[model samples]
Target: MKIIVSADIGNSETKMITRYDGVEGSECFHQPSVIRKLIKSPQIAETNLKKNVINLDENLIAHITSSALNRHSDGLYVIGKKAMQTDLNKVQNMNIKLGNKHKHDIPVIMILAMIARTVVKDEFELNGALESSYQIDCDFVSAIPASEFTFEKAKEFEKRLTKGDHTVVIHLGDKKVMVGINFKKAKITQEGIPAIFAMVYDNEENDDRKVSLLDKFNEVYDEEMEPNDLLKMKIFHVDIGDGTTEYIYTNGVNPVIDACDGERRGVGHATEDAVIMLNEMLQGSFKSSRQSFMEIIKDKTHNLHSEAFNALEAAKGTQANEILEDTFEKIQNKAGNSVDLITVYGGGSIQFREHLEESLRDYAETINSKLLWVPEELAVNLNVRGLDILNRTVFSKNKK
Candidate 1:
């Protein structure tokens, strides 16, 4: 059977989901959105190979791995957390995963790497072993920000991934393998639409994240309306990420162009500022990058916990306020009266909720509209989960 995967190539991380477990369930995978260009040379010690396990395409490569693509790209790179170990200064840090960057080779490579790693894990699970080389056929689905979710952008993205052969050499412990993802079908979905689809269709009854859309609609509207009316009611979705936040207005699953926009002020900006401030404040005594600072602050028992605990909190509050006043509040002021329901989600929503929850509730109450701060556990994966749901239902059916 051809593999079906739904992916979200986020700025801070990449999330991909597949119905590999079964039709009723899914397996979600994550990879850090980090990559670095590397030169495979004698400079890479044998010890480094043992640690990260990458092999060069040499005379011995034929004995250990198989090839499908005629020639690999000259730009050799490492991605995800492993890439983080290299020059921290040079690593592909937080950047908006939209516009030209969305269709660039790095993003495409990241997408393929996520798929390749997932396929490898599944292979190990199914067969209780690893493969030296594997090339799998797949149906790929991923999304960009709703603001850029246009026909031209989506087509360009699809062309970039499916236009040419995509194969990568991956490293394992003391070994290497070539894995390729051949996308039989590629789909680009808007960021928030899929989450709404998940809410309406794919949510589990017993799951705490399972929101009652119809029930919410009924409670809010207090009127019996046909299913067709569901398409007419406007629902605004606010998706917050580490590097970007998307404010989208939707009638059913379709985005309203005039009301939708994306901004660069996200949780990452706050953490980054905190990192810079803390570095200067302590005179480089406790050196921390953004990711390291976040990790340090989260771990209560860490040595730097005392320093990070409250400093980052202040930065977070300030950043959240900036985001609220600058983008979300403006969106609320302009569109509140016209919109029926407002839903807030995405990976970084959890961080901003403490500051935003009550204020949003007040506005929502004042405007006679309902608000949903999607449950934290479900927020991040909702988009990809929805895409996964479509992959099994609408997409497959349309293919038939």
Candidate 2:
């Protein structure tokens, strides 16, 4: 039977999907695109074969995905879930930073290969163990952001797969998601759409980090607000992440505005803080290396617990509100009647959902249309989902 596998690999997360015939299969396998290793026998380095896993120092690839860079004697290298156990001081590459620096599809290809290997290995092992008569192989269909999609790149990526080619698409949209179908296949037709930038730098001040349709609100909606004594309120939204924090602001119905002044906090620092606090608050799992904000808070952190914890207690939707409310209060004075409803989303949405909800409730009391707080899954994946929608629309139109 013919098989096609689609892989969506982003800096923050990796998703892999497999399909038989034309229908999407069950769950798509996924993993962080990181490998950790330690020096096993430095002197024994000689022959080399195809690169299977990243070799940091050549040990047994301890931990295998992430590891601490401690100069200590014991080589306990770790990667991914295992590497997250160490403090930021000890570990690096936890965020899996990838952008223009590396080849565009390098990270995704690595992740796809890993997924293919795992799936192929499992099928082979199980079939052999059960003494089955036949063997199975996999083909991969990798996807990239539609705005950034390219047929040449797709072809190059397919060539590297060696397993099989992948179908690539671009994901778009805000609350509603869409995808542009055959984005790689139709270069001329798809060129009209605006180019979307990867979230390399949250700040637009950087020359390379231009604003996108995602930041449409920031571009249009020309209005201003001065702090109003009546509401006596200020609001700020921060998209806290492993590498940086994104801040958006509003006084009262002036539309969400980007805050100019803020700190570039890393995910490791935020995670480290969360880990320390959770360590203090609870025992058992929290104390163990497996402890995550999702486990303790029973919500997603995407690695932004420290700020979310504070936001929750203050009844604010996002951590940015807590930190930058003062600035917003100043802008609230000249504002209109409508209280600004803050919508926060990202990998850290679940981390601050409870807090953001409380903040929205406060907005509802004074304003119309209640405050909005979209979760991380929807927030980050919104564009991809949007592209998918576009893809379907185009497909139907073409059929007609």
Candidate 1 regions off by >4 Å? 20-25, 41-76, 97-99, 205-233, 284-289, 326-336, 396-400
**TM-score, predicted candidate 2 vs. hidden true structure:** 0.41
lDDT of 2 by residue, 150-253 (tens): 55654554444442333221111111111111112211111101011112112321233233322443323342322132133344444443333344344432
- TM-score of every model? 0.80, 0.41
TM-score of 1: 0.80
Q: By how many angstroms RMSD does model 1 differ from the true structure?
A: 5.8
Local accuracy of candidate 1 as per-residue lDDT tens digits, 323-382: 666545645664656777777888888888888877877777777776767777677887
